[model samples]
Target chain A: MYFFQKNKYKIMLVASTAVLVVCIIVGSAINRRKAGGASDALGTVFTPLQSGVTGASDSVSGFFNYLTNMKGYEKENEKLREKIASLEDELRKTDNLKSENERLRKMLDLKENEKDYKTVAADVVAFEMDNFSKSYTINKGIKDGITQSCAVITPYGLVGYVSEVGRNWAKVCPIVDSKVSVSASIMRVGNTAIVQGDIGLMEDGLCKMTYVSKETGLEVGDSIETSGSGGVIPAGIYIGKVTEIKNDVTGVSQEAVIKPGVDFSDVNEVMVIKDN
Target chain B: MNYVLSYLTLAVLFVLQTTLGRYIDICGIAPDIIFVYVLCYSMYNYPVRAAVLSIIAGIIVDLYSSTHVGLNALLYMYIGLAVSNFASTLMKKNVWTVALGVVVLSILYHTVVLITQYVIAGHSGFVYPFVRIALPTAVYDGVVSLVLSLWAQWLSMDKIRGL
Candidate 1:
C-alpha cells in the first residue's frame, strides 16, 4: 500500500502506455475487419461538429476568394455567357445525336454498354489533417446506402473509394492516395494498365500508371479511365490524363504520371456510386 | 479551473486545425496547432497530466484522421513526457524556448511517423517526405509557436508565469 501510494504517478504512466499499445493492436485488427464501434461512435459525435465548422470555414474562404477575385468576376461572367450560348447550341446537336444513336442501338439489337449507377451526393465536411494520406470525410454514411469500397466521383472524373464509413460520415481515400489502386486503360490506345497512387507523386496531385507493355505507345496527353475489372468501381469512369512517362525502377516496365480530372484539393461535393 | 481552461483551449484548437488549417496551408502543409498546444501545455504542467492530456489529444486526432487509433497517442505521450522533463530543467520559459521545443519535437514527430509508416505499411521513399514535409513543417511550426507564445505572453502575464 505504501509503495502504491509512493509510485502512483509512475504506475499510472506505465498502465496508460500499456493500454495504448493494446489499443493499437486492437485498433489495427478492427480496422482490417471494418469500422469498429469506437470509430463509429467518434464519427457520430464529431460529424455534426465537423460539418458546422467546415461550413463556417468554407463561408469565410468563399468571402475572401470573392474579395480577391472581384475585379476578374465581371470578365469571367462575360466569358461564361458566351460559352453558355455556344454550349446551348452544341446541346441541341447532342440531343439529336443521342436520339439517332438510340434508334441505331435498337435497330442493331445492341445491349446497353453503360450501366446507370445509383449515386448519392454528399458534401465534403472535413479532410484528413495529416499529409501522409489524401482522404476526406463526407456527410453521408451507411444510412445513405454508402458502404466500404463504394466508388466516389465528381462530374469531372473519378475521385476515389469509400475507405471507412461512420453513422453519418464516411472517409474517402482519393485516387491520389498511396493506398489506392485502380484498373485503368488508356483511352487512346485501349491498352490496360494499373493506376496507383505513388508517394512521390502524391504531393504533386498525381498518380502513376504502371504495368505498361513496352509495345504500347503512351503519349503525354493520353486519357485514362477505369476499366472496372475489380467489380468495385464501375467501368468507363474517367480518371485522368497522362502528364509524364518514365521507366520503372526495375527497368522492365514503364510508368506514366496521371493528373486526375477531379481537382482533389478543391473537392466540395462528391457522388458515391451505390449500385448499378 | 486551469485544467478546464487548458482543455477548452485544446478543443478550440482542434476544431480550427481541422477546418481553418486547410485554408491557410502553405504549399499543402498546415501548422499542427494541436501539436503546438500540447507541446506548450506539457512544458508548463506536470508530466503525468501532460501525458494524459497528450493521449487524449492524440486519440482525438487518430479518431478523426488516422485509420489506426494509438500510433499518435503513443507518440504524443512520449513527447509530452519528454517536453515536461526538458522544461523542468530550464531556468526560464519564453517564446524562443517554446519555439525551439516545437521545432525539435515537430521534426522528431514526423521522423517517427515516417518510420512507423514504413515499418507497418512498407512505405518507402523517406527522403521526399523528410525534405518536402518534415523540414518545412518544423520551421513553420516553430514560427507559429513563436507567434502564439508571444501572443499568450501578451494576453496574460500570469497565465504563462514562467514566460
Candidate 2:
C-alpha cells in the first residue's frame, strides 16, 4: 500500500506499457492473418465521414483551380478544338481498322483478351497521411465485389493492388510502397525483371527494377509491363518506363529506375478489376 | 481545458489530417498535426490523462492506416509519457520550450518509425529516408507547433497559468 501510494503514476505507466506491448504482438499476428475485424468496424463508421469531407474539399479545390487557371483553360480549349477535328478524321480510319482487325481475329480464332476482366470504378476518399507509405482509401469495398489483392488501375496505367478491404471501403497500396513488388517485363527486349519499391526512390515517385539479366540490353525510356508471372495482377498492364540503368554491386545482374505512367498525386478515380 | 472538448478537437483535426492534409504537404511530406497536439496537451495535463489520450490517438491512427493496429499506439504512449515528464521538470512552460520539445519528439518519432520499418520489413538505405523525410518533417512540425502552442496558450490562459 505504501509503495503503491508513493509511485502510483510510475506504476500506472509501467502497467499500461506492458498492456500495449501485448497488444502489439496480438495485433501483428491478426494483421498477418488478414483478419481485420476491428479495422472493418472502424472503417464502416469513418468511411462516410471521409467521403463527405473529400467531396467538400474537392469542390473547394476545383473552384480555386478554375479561378486561377481561367486563362490557361481558354488556350487549352482552343488547342483541344483543333485536336478534336484531327481526331475525328482519325476515328474514321480507326473504325475501318477495327472492323478489319475483328475479321482477322475471327479468321485466326483469337479471343479478345481485353474483355476478360470487369472493373468497378471508385473515388478516392482519403490518402495516407504519413510519409513512410503510399496508400489511399477508395469508397467502394467488399459489397461492391472488390476483394483483397485486386488490381487497381487508371486509364493511364497500373495504380496498385488492394491491400485491405472493409464493407464500404478498401485501402490500395500502390506499386511505390516499400513492401510491394511486381514481376515486370521490358517491352523492347522482352526480358523479365522484378520491379520493387525502395524507400529511397519513393519520395521521387519512382521505383527500382532488379534481377535483370546481363544481356537484357535495357535502355532509357524502355516500357515495362506486368509479366503475368503471378496471377493476381493481369498481364501486360503498363507499369512504367525505364529512366536509368545500373549494374548490381555484385556484378552479376543489373537494375533500372522506373517512372510510373500514372501520377499518383493527382489520381482521383480508379477502376478495380474484379473476377481476376 | 476540458478533456471532452480536447478529445473532440483532436477527432476533428484527425479527420482533416486524413482528408485535406495532402493539399498542404510540402514536397510530398505532410506535417503531423495530431502529434503536435498530443505533445502540447501532455505538457499541460497529468501524465496518466495524457497517456490515455495518447493511446486513443494512436488507436485512431492505427485503425485508419494500413499498419498493424498497435504499432502507433505503442509509439504514441511512450511519447506522451516522455513529454509529460519533460514538461514537469522544466523551469517554465512556454511556446519556445514546447516548440523545442516538438522538434525533439518529432525526430524521435520518425527515428523509431524508420527503425521499426527496417526491422519488420527489412527496408534498406536508412540515410536517404532519415535525411529526406525525417529531418524536414521535424523542422516542419517544429514551426507548426510554435504557432499551435501559441494559439493553445491564448485559448486557455488561466489553465496554463495554473499549470
lDDT tens string, model 2, A1-276?
999999998898788778878877877777532327777887788788888999999999999999999999999999999999999999999999999999999999998867557999999998886787878999999999999999999988999899888989999989888888988999998899999888888878899999999888889999999997888888889999999999989999998999999897888899999877
lDDT computed for candidate 1: 0.83
True contacts kept of each: 0.56, 0.69
DockQ of each: 0.61, 0.70
Model 2 over residues B1-163: C-alpha lDDT tens digits? 5666778777777878888988988998888888888888777766777788898888888787736667888889888887777677763787887888899889989888887865356865678888888888888898888877765555445455335
Candidate 2 docking DockQ: 0.70
**Which regions of candidate 1 fall more than 4 Å away from where they truly are?**
B118-120, B147-163
Across B57-94, the per-residue lDDT of candidate 1 in tens digits comes to 99888777765689899889989888877786763787
**Candidate 1 lDDT by residue in tens digits, A1-276:** 999999997898799889999988988777532467777887787778888999988898899999999989999999999999999999999999999999999999999886788999999987777667778889999999999999999999999999888878899989998878989989998989999887778877889899998789899999999998878888899999999999988988899999999987799999999983
Model 1 docking grade: medium
Cα misplacement distance, residue A239 of candidate 1 (Å):
0.7
